[model samples]
Target: MDILLNVVNYILGFGAAVFVPLIMFVLGLCVKMKPGDAFIAALTLGIAFTGMNTITSFMTGAIQPAAEGLADKTGLALTTVDTGWPAMSAIAWAWPFGVLCFPLLIVINIILLVTNKTNTLNVDLWNVWNLLFTAVLINYACEEAGMGTTVAMVLAFVGAGLMAALGIKIGDMWAPSIEKITGIPGVTVPHSMTFTAVLMFPFELILEKIPAIQNNNVDAKWLRDHFGIFGENSVMGLIIGIVLGAIAYGELQAALTLGIQAATAMVLFPMVSKLFMQALSPISDAVGDWMKAKFQDGRELYIGLDWPIVAGSNELWVLTILLIPVELIFAVVLAPIGNTVLPFAGIINTCCAVPALLLTGGNLIKMLILGIIATPVYLMVGSSFAGYCTRLAQTWSPDSLAGMGENPSITWSTMECPDFRWVLVNGLSGHVVAIVLLIVWLALFVLLYKHMAKRNVEIKKELGR
Candidate 1:
């Protein structure tokens, strides 16, 4: 296959800060480690992914030119042009079934971990390009319904392998509260934007059965113990970068240089998530002691990873700077009532709501009411998949539409995957209204995964788990 697309484009051209710490120093010398602790745990996970890409490029260079100067001073005549997620991952790697969807999702996650269904060994292979951006837009909407392109690449690779087997059952329901806050037990985070927090677990159990939001018990360690060090988290990201640089640069020296680059991205995103949990705790303890000397049924394994190791909390940077002006004023007053396409680009405030604010465990009022009702349903499902993502970026990456400028006629990406419910279930899959909206969203995720697995066994018997 053209030498596996020239060795996956020469290891994605040495990018992810040199191929994710040279694939975690060759997965810590394929679990045998001790080559000077896998070269100091792959040079401290490539210096914690170059200090979380230099504090996410100083918080997207002070919030993408103040969100393209509030979408060019709010003259909202929107015509698709949001263009973020790296030009929709260069039109999902210029489709033709996106370069064998990265070795068919690493051979369907190693045949769902050698057929024991799954134990989630996903190994965040470069975020499998968000599952090959919804399997190259559902293999170009099942090759515009005539199918055959080898049955539209096996029906968009079994609908992106059933969304990575429902993101490994949402990383086995948040791997025991992320191994009780990073002691790093099994591990999780099967990603696709933290599996859209299973569409907000039945609206956070109907806002925790509203006895006034169940006594609101505002979290983030009670705003760092009732505002002690100016309620630190890098001083509330220097007061939300001096109120988003005084509402987009009404300068007090560019709002204190975007409040010292949002207080150095809230104090270096938890010191680059404690150097990516000290380089994934000795390769997650050498893959849980090589799955206990190669699995003798004590089973338990997880790993998966990415969602910036539980997105540096402090209520996910105060509900990502109060939902960046409520996702740019709800994409300018609900993009003419949800017909979609307004965001000029702020990458849905903190890269598509930091995987539903670490699946709402950092409950800044339930991630600010699920980012004010899912940032206008991700700007009307990224404006109903912005005309088939601007006709799959002018038919397979016209040099990513001449590098996003040649004057935007159309483009889209408020958080990736040729979006808006993957263009309403790959433009209504083979029809019958996308199999009755995929059996009513799989019977509302089997009654919200049996009411969040009986509210996670009554929150693990009220924490005496």
Candidate 2:
């Protein structure tokens, strides 16, 4: 029965993944958009952003050894999974919800569009999916490559920003020349692509031979010097040689630190300006360049402005605060509900965070409500289905469990035994305590919201709104 159930569950989970995207595409079609457009949007939202779990899994597998080695070197416990409240909740629930809540997400988005008078469906903001996906992917890549979180975040921010900016800048600069040369309307040489490709081999070499340099502060100067090399041939050689020499000297820590900081500054400068563009003519330079390209009938004008880069509204901090309780409820309450019907079923809770974050527009309150309501249903229905599918996989691939015997070895018995006495005492009880604390936090948030609402009402009355 367990085996049969696991099979059924796997099929159901897979179905949900497929169905949700299809429904989203259909919704797009209803709005006179192409199916491809809808798929792209869904991909941006679902697979691109929320699929960080898959990237994390890959990175975890790759970086485990490096992390352990770092721990051995630094003697700091920086390698362990963050098992704190909401992070723990994410571990327990985010992935499962990602898989199960596809259809519900479509329904929710539709509702939000229909009901909200002020909030129009900004397809542009859907770019958040791209940002989320890229962040996670880059994060995993850096971590797996032995880069610490701080270093990775800095590099990612710098690298992505520089590449994006250079691409736009170079494209703008070369637009007229490219058009005159090629006679193509929207086709122009991608300066960013050239820059990236040029840097790739050298970057890889640096990462490979002198892995420790990832901790360094030399990245910024390197980018600045190389930033001007598109014009000069000999300068390019000099840049390459310097980069190689730095890596050979294993000054990665310095290089990385400097590079990240510089890159961050470059990226954030424009973003900050965009933020206060209303008060100041910030990014006026870039805007002027864009206008020149458009006036000149250059393809470079198509390199649209990345509003997020221009506006420092990452909102990650806001999302984190809002998501805490939702994560807690799913990890603590809903996970157990699934486990009761299906042994080894607690892992499915990892899916809950996906819907909570994506569907709720990263709103903490909505996520908390959804987590309270939806997790139980997912666990009951989704886990039962997933558990059964896993059993089926085992049955089908007997060699997958070939080592098992009627009288399995003591070690195996200890490891695989269903006995949960210690687990209940340690894991369950500890989780329960965590959940209680989360509930208190939620209560405080509710009170805060109420107070804010009252203040808003008072302001509205004063203004006669």
Best by TM-score: 1
For candidate 1, report its TM-score.
0.34
Candidate lDDT scores, in order, read: 0.68, 0.31
lDDT of 2: 0.31
Over 86-174, each residue of candidate 1 has an lDDT whose tens digit, in order, gives 65775766665566767777777788778877777766676677676776667667777777788877777777777777776666666
Per-residue lDDT of candidate 2, residues 1-465 (tens digit): 445445434543443234334444554555455566555654543442223333323323322232233223333221112221222212222222122222322343345435531121222221222222223334344555576878765554443342333333333333333222222222223222122211122323344355344333222233345555431323332333234234323466543443333234333333333322221121223334544655564212222221221112222222222232333334344443332221111222223433233222233344344444543443233332232222322333333334445421111100110111111111212346534643543354344334334544554355443
Off by over 4 Å in 2: 1-8, 11-20, 26-40, 43-47, 50-70, 74-439, 451-465
Q: Residue 427: error of model 1 in Å?
A: 18
Each model's total of backbone clashes:
1, 44
In candidate 2, position 369 carries an lDDT of 46
lDDT of 1: 0.68
Alpha carbon lDDT at 382, candidate 1? 66
Candidate 2 backbone clash number: 44
